[model samples]
Target: MSKKILLSWLFMAILCLPVFAQIQEPVKFKTEWKSVSADEVEIVFTGKMEKGWHVYSTDLPEGGPISATFNTDKLEGAEVVGKLKPAGKEIDKMDPIFGMQVRFFEGTATFVQKIKLKGGKYEVSGYLQYGACNDENCLPPTNVEFSFKGEAAGKQTAEEVVATTEDLALADTASVDLVPLRIGEDTAAGEAADYWKPVIKELSSFGENVNNESHSWIYIFFAGFVGGLLALFTPCVWPIIPMTVSFFLKRTKDKRKGIRDAWTYGASIVVIYVTLGLAITLIFGASALNDLSTSAVFNILFFLMLVVFAASFFGAFEITLPSKWSNAVDSKAEQTTGLLSIFLMAFTLSLVSFSCTGPIIGFLLVEVSTSESIVAPAIGMLGFAIALALPFTLFALFPSWLKSMPKSGGWMNVIKVTLGFLELAFALKFLSVADLAYGWRLLDRETFLALWIVIFALLGMYLLGKIKFPHDDDDTKVSVPRFFMALASLAFAVYMVPGLWGAPLKAVSAFAPPMQTQDFNLYKNEVHAKFNDFDAGMEYARQQGKPVMIDFTGYGCVNCRKMELAVWTDPTVSKLLNEDYVLITLYVDEKTKLPEPVKVMENGTERTLRTVGDKWSYLQRSKFGANAQPFYVLLDNEGMPLNKSYSYDEDIQKYVEFLQTGLKNYKR
Candidate 1:
């Protein structure tokens, strides 16, 4: 009877083992902030695990158990400079549950995130998400919230703490007189006003769509189509159109059958190009290509590639595939029948005409890749294919139309050489991006304009038959078409001359180095922001009893510059901003550190303001719920919205009205 009773108790204990494990928390976390430099701080998270229990590290592969992750729920005054780093005695071994190698800490784990403060004071708040496991059981992912605040690095705290009389008496004997700083005062009344407070709820009714939608894909497609049209005029492609059509007409006695074959051939061309685009996307992946598009190495490589293509177009040498490859493709086309044979023939054309079309296609693909859309490459190719293939099918359907087409001659070479010069000019733009990123300053705005001017002038001369390339015919007289093109080129060169002296030259602002880079400029008839600090600007506006216009912009914003040049330069708009409103321009990308971090509760979440930019960005987001740059808001002295906000619209009249409405509202 005693043995049976003991066995029953053992069974119950075995069943209750997992229940006991569930009731006990295995890991405890403690977070601390360590000032690493005058402008940097490190948030250290230390995790203590119970014996035989472990927690996973970050960056484990997918399809495995959850890995540790640190999520910043609120970041205001400081920027996270680097990734979270883990340190401890980690056990990296394969786990049967995940069937993969996993890393975890057994006794203790330390994670650190280094942050750069825009100002001396900063507040950071986030949660650590981790999963703990043991030999027989696994714990679900858990979150531990952390909040930290610190002053400027190396700033000793002067905070006074009250203590009991006995504790105070235990201090070292030093004769000192302590004086009270303030007594029986209303501290709340003396506290500084918060400029970033949420506006009245009625202001929400005036909100506009803050989303900056992109329509670049449509532009990219049309650009590709234009490129295809240009490629069709090249020497290699123009001559082949008639010959290919003639062969198709002669091969089949029935004209309808011949036309059908031509259509099939054109479709094959599109398939070939579209497949090439899909291959590029699949090989590189969208995320990687997006990153690569902005990388310095990618920009430099594209610059060199364009230069090489330009040289080839200048008649330095032909860029062609090996003869054997085309020969082999031609042989297969002859052997095959029906659509297969037509596809092979189209493949042959692609290979043979690559010398002429290769540069255009390469350049098209390069530009399209920068759009960062996964399907952009393929869409661009589709447009190019339709434009290229249209001529072949149309000519075959109407054989008589072939005679009206312009004969391939010196004009074709002129087209090619013109493209060469344009390519050379555009290559500089790519180099400029890399130069700015690395602070090389080798190719400044003036230098770039000079090169473009010289190149375009030379191109104009070439069009006038005064300049000759290697492939040009010895013709002294220029065609009427060439004369007009030359005039346009010279006119464009003349237009850019003013830009050298720091003219906004709104036309080329997107490509040119910013006006700030120019060393010499005479154009000063522009509007300037009255203040950059929110608090200072708001207080001054209140004293002046004027409306406030907050311009949320960025250092690298292209549209912001365009708006300033196009709309802000208008006399009416400038007058209102200068006289009727106090303008505050906040650069969201500013890197200046703040003197001290300011803490505030925003939307029921704590936010730390460590930099000037952070304070402005937080204001824009919390109050306006907008983060995109070139954001404009009109407010009264009390921080209430005066009118609807504006964005990248450059309509001078509309902008004038926007300002007038706000000024009128402020007066009311």
Candidate 2:
């Protein structure tokens, strides 16, 4: 009797083991669309979403998913009537805190794009790019080019919309513009457009769609601004700002001529910049744009390069080329005194401006590289060149205005010193890049913030006449510009001080501090909800039967702050969050540490786990192939990787779309 009982108990125990392993299931995500009319297209997306798996919003990471965007482009004789809105059917979701009352289905989600075509037949085609995540991990984002030929609709019905999606045909939006590419002398600035044509075409051929929504347009705008700022300090440009005015004044003996020359200089700069942008597009095309901007080596190199520029600004070194070259260019300009002379003048300006402009140029290369658009870097460079070339161009065009300009003595040095502070602060970012890539974590958020505090504070003091430098001529009285600069630096310091106490500091949250380091924050829109442990959060996600969102963040990550403020605050964004996820913020810079003594092998060294950030960073590098902040992931309740992970973006709408897709995958 005892032996029989034992055998029966053993069988029951074995039965329970399989039940425990039932915590997760593998899920696949697939999307399809149907056109209801030339003006209205319905998206019928299906998620082979597995049990206990979930994806996230389009707003999840800035670039993780393509925003479920609908557009009506160039309707020859047509006008876009309206925007695409979601009134769709979805998979069923089971959750307590999030996604509890949501109606979702594991197999399909339907979205409608309503467009009122105005009186003409046009080819209507667009792309559908979404970031999908399953139970364990999120997948790298993929997009589809969807297209259709529909006539202006006279009428429509719900049933017709549903039927069209089920039987959609291949889209005709597969016209790819491939610029041919050629490898030439390394010294060449870039390859010709013909060189990249084949590459762009080939990538476009991979799938019939071209959707690269990961990069935010704001970044491009910012690139323009930074480029302008860098150009302002270049010697080639700055000295000429006044000299060019004098030259035109001497030649025409009219203030107006100088102004015209200055204007010409500015115009030439713009032309140069725009051409550079075109060249970049011609060389790399669209495919390389995405990788160019977010590289660690690029950032580090840029930072070091900036340091060199800063040193030059401090008069540590003279960045001039051989006198022979300058003389040669000058001689050529004298020989050809028309546009070529202007061009020669510009050439001289460029050579002279190298010291001041080099750092900015380097920054352009690094930041522009992050863009997925072939023209991004060039466009960015163009913006800078224009800014640098502006003063001379405008002053030459109106030479009389040059008299209003401040004398360039002590003020110039002061400007250089102020910029040096910025240089130092920015250098840490590059070092942080290296640290993150190599698993150093030496310049993590708190440390970074601390460094900025010091650099800026010193700048403020220096501006206030409390400090002196090697080039000082004894007069330390503060000018208004210098005062303002100092004040701005101090204000920045004040802004970051709150972060050390655990504030999110949303404005620059992406780049300032990691969320993990934040003592108090509310990423979740739900009121009064407190989450203090990772396991608890995961359990809640499991019980709610939704996916867990693990946010690996840190203090001093400028991009992170920008993302949180710019994206997470949107209304469509917040509502979706409350409905779909259990948010877990892991601050890679948090000072918290493992409770007991723990030693782990990292980068070939067995080191004792030091702080909270150490553990999280170790996990991030070991698992996710990253060391940057604002990293996001969607996992099943039981901790399986879902789809490919996404990085970050600055757009709120796109982020919202990312989450919606993640939810669809989770339900499946």
Candidate 3:
């Protein structure tokens, strides 16, 4: 009887053991509210997790870990302005169980949400659902209820209130600061008085799109391939092709071994170039590369570097690596056997041809480094190396083919001189970028167009044999290819002439600075927005009974300019943007500083919003969860989205349809 009683007790203890483990709470929550404006209040939720425990962020992907979610009990009197933002540092790690990346907060975490009050005061009740985990175990999902009272604050005198309300109605909180109105203002002078008010737009996230990143990689790769083809024609590289292949063919007894050795040499060249690219990526990192691409100092340095390269191409000097470096590699090739010798031979070729290939490689690297992808440099180098290596391997396999190839002559000098002029023209582009970014106004649109016109005209004259550099042949007659190139250059020069007098010159718009940089203008593209501030544009839209089109753009954004010139310039799209919709262009790269800095919690981290650009960037990220430029969003007067957002697509018909759809939605 005693043994049976003891067995029953043990069974009961086993059942209760699981229940005892569930009793402890590993995380605690606290909530509070702060007033931002008369109509908007910010609700902050802070979570404190026990030691060795963590709570997942709201943005974590599903099927990996449970994320924290927030919901309001009632949506009648108040509405959430944007997504719930994390207010503390987050730890991102790969989850062993789920086989994916997960972001979680350890220790303490804070989240914030903006709530806009429609009218009268009420209690805003909400519940946060979250899951906590530790190294050993994960607790079951839990919910914590939270509530905060909302009240309109910052009420002013009747005169102040009237002025403040009017200003607020016309101001976008994202990019502009609100200015208090003065009492006893003249009604006739109201338009002038309104200029002083600050514009505001709610801040959001500015993350880069994944698809755009992939597209950038493709663009860089193509650019590098073209650069390599151009490099192959330069005086330094062109002369070596026949000699390198012949050396390999004569050195080996067996034809098969010669072909294999030549192939190995080409592969070695690719490895060397790709390794150089990898070294650059490892040294600078993605973020630093981006910064370097845009930095004024770096741009200026590149301008100088290209200028030096141009002079070298013009025969002022030869830009070559150390002779000893090439000799050392050449000696190794002479001594070593098999693949090692072939690789050293290829290394010698690279070193000897650096005068021509170095500038091209440098330019390509600078261009590719701006892309968001870490492997962009490597991909670009791969493309270039393939183009550079193809000739050597192919020539080796068919030594007879060398007889059909153009003999190295004065034609190589002509190619070098042409590249010199081209390099000079491209160098101006980097200088222009620096000028525009720093607001120096040194390279204005008119000046830039004038310089380009001269450069191309000179190039045309040079191609026509009217102008001669140091190494040009005395032949007066131009070849058919050279004549056509001269004609093309002259045509391009003539096209740019009209741009000085304010022509759009849409073909080269991506390379040129903004039209706003032009001091004089005759042809107006009509793409400029009526209002750049969101609230001001929306107010005008409401009064005119039109929908709002928000253009998220940037001064530094190349694709934004491309879209403007290609798609927005279309008559149908232009007409809709001008008449049917209230266009608001928010420049995310605007350099204007905010009158006062604002520090706010974003994605669980505190960041200082110190400029107009930062505010708009934050607004875009927080409100729509988008951070890329050339992003467009259409909305009704009450701030509701009218249709899906648009990105860097240039299909005019699609853009027109997007506008029409938004207009149709707004009407409904």
Candidate 4:
């Protein structure tokens, strides 16, 4: 009897061991539902594995690892269609323990299944059976349950239906019919339209291009600092530094008080500039400023403003504030005491130096406003103020250092004239943006390049004393610094001359108009895509029994053009793209409008889709979870992704391998 009782306890312990092991499994499962159409839904299952553990794929061979399997409970009006599809990177290796090749997924994996629905809403209950293993141990097969419910179709008003239909018709003309698959009236029309809305906030989070707000702030700060340094060399600002510091030192017999007052004056300058930056940000708001940065009207305005600034620098006219303002501030400085006197003095200097510093400040603000950060302008102003104030504070601290500083003279006027030429060249960049957006054809690639070449050539001649401006001294001999500036200007001009006939000119690609705008061609590569539309490219791929390569780009995208010239121009990459795949180039900046306007909801916000660019931009965001340009994805004829997507990488071999890998996967 004792032996039998011991055996019974052992048996019970053996049975409970499996249950305890199942509870310790490291993989977790989750399910989500997406409406594909009225009759179909996409069920996405994600498996998250703990560190150092992995789960086997469904296609693993027999006697290898335990493959993941999905089984559904009885459904009221739904049936599974096709097989489960894997949607993440997979690893294949020869396992010594199993003595066979095996495929598994580590970290996270997404598997999708299509389900056909009859009607109404339904809860799809399912259980996923899978096994996980680490380097040291393997767990037995375990089951986890999940359920998700979604509506088969959203209710759409008659106007919405009509608008969607007309939009589809317009899209069809562009060979990009975006109609949701449904019989008769699309029951998923509202759902489809909602999916296409601009996901601006989400794109920065989950999309491939993460927000670099901090990085942008750093760049803006440095740019402002450089601009401030340039402003200090101007005739108006440079001469005042010595005079202002001498006034403070000579007026105060106490050296400590003189230094303290000078530092206060510098601090006051910083405060004033930073306050202006804050005012601009508060008035416009960050989001509005971001939009304004991309607006055609604002670009044109910036262009005109820069041109005016250039003219001022060229001695066309003085850009000055009212004299009364500076005089009042000057009087206040004389009447006040302590820090207040220094603050008033700093304000007076700012007003007096406006003719020189105003253009620099305006250009800096215009550049900083383009950054997508709320505090970017403030940070930029702080940098500029710090640079502008450093010299005055240091000279006051060590009065003898002022003797080492270069005396203001005719060279200051030369600096201003050189800056004038640079301003004129940069102003055209803003004009190019407006011209491209509005399709004005006023400044094409060749025309823009010609203007730049002429401007820089003339600048070179002026620097070498061959050309003279109104404010230039009568000296004909070029200084050492002027000679170097002339050489740089001439070299830059010579470099840009090739760009007129289709040279990439990558150094200035960001500023120059796109190469497509050039009529004549000499450096053209032979990798042109046969189709620039999605549906047409896919259809061609299907007919030819090849995979599809989708290039999500933009007309204004500098990186896209760079990749085309730098990487895609390679013979290996070009052949693979042109022969092995049906290439589709979707320009997300195409501004042509649709036949009818369609409104869509995104994260509770309503957005109206009106242009061709909007439709392609929406497609890229919705389908691939990305919004940045120069995005590349490989797809089979069925629109299923073949492999991992790519972004702005300029490696030729990597791109060739990406294409080859997609082709291999498609053939398999």
Candidate that scores best on TM-score: 1
User: Which candidate, 1 or 3, would have the higher lDDT against the true structure?
Assistant: 1
lDDT, candidates in the order shown: 0.73, 0.53, 0.71, 0.71
Look at candidate 2 and tell me the lDDT of residue 13: 93
Summarize candidate 1's per-residue lDDT along 287-343 as a digit string, tens digits. 456556555667789889889999999999999999999999999999989999999
Q: Please state every model's RMSD to the true fold in angstroms.
A: 17.4, 26.0, 17.8, 19.9
Query: Residue pairs in steric clash, candidate 4?
Result: none
- Please identify model 2 stretches exceeding 4 Å from their true place: 1-222, 233-236, 252-262, 277-293, 516-668
Query: Which segments of candidate 3 are over 4 A away from where they belong?
Result: 1-215, 436-440, 527-566, 575-645, 651-668
Best by lDDT: 1
Q: For residues 449-560, could you state the per-residue lDDT of candidate 3 as single tens digits?
A: 9999999999999999999887788989889999999999999999999999887777777577767778888886758889866556656776788888888776545466
Model 4: lowest-lDDT 10 consecutive positions: 164-173
**How close to the true structure is residue 176 of candidate 4, measured as C-alpha lDDT?**
29
| Candidate 2 CA-lDDT value | 0.53
Write model 4 residue lDDT over 274-341, tens digit each, in one string. 99888889999865675566567787898999999999999999999999999998998889887888
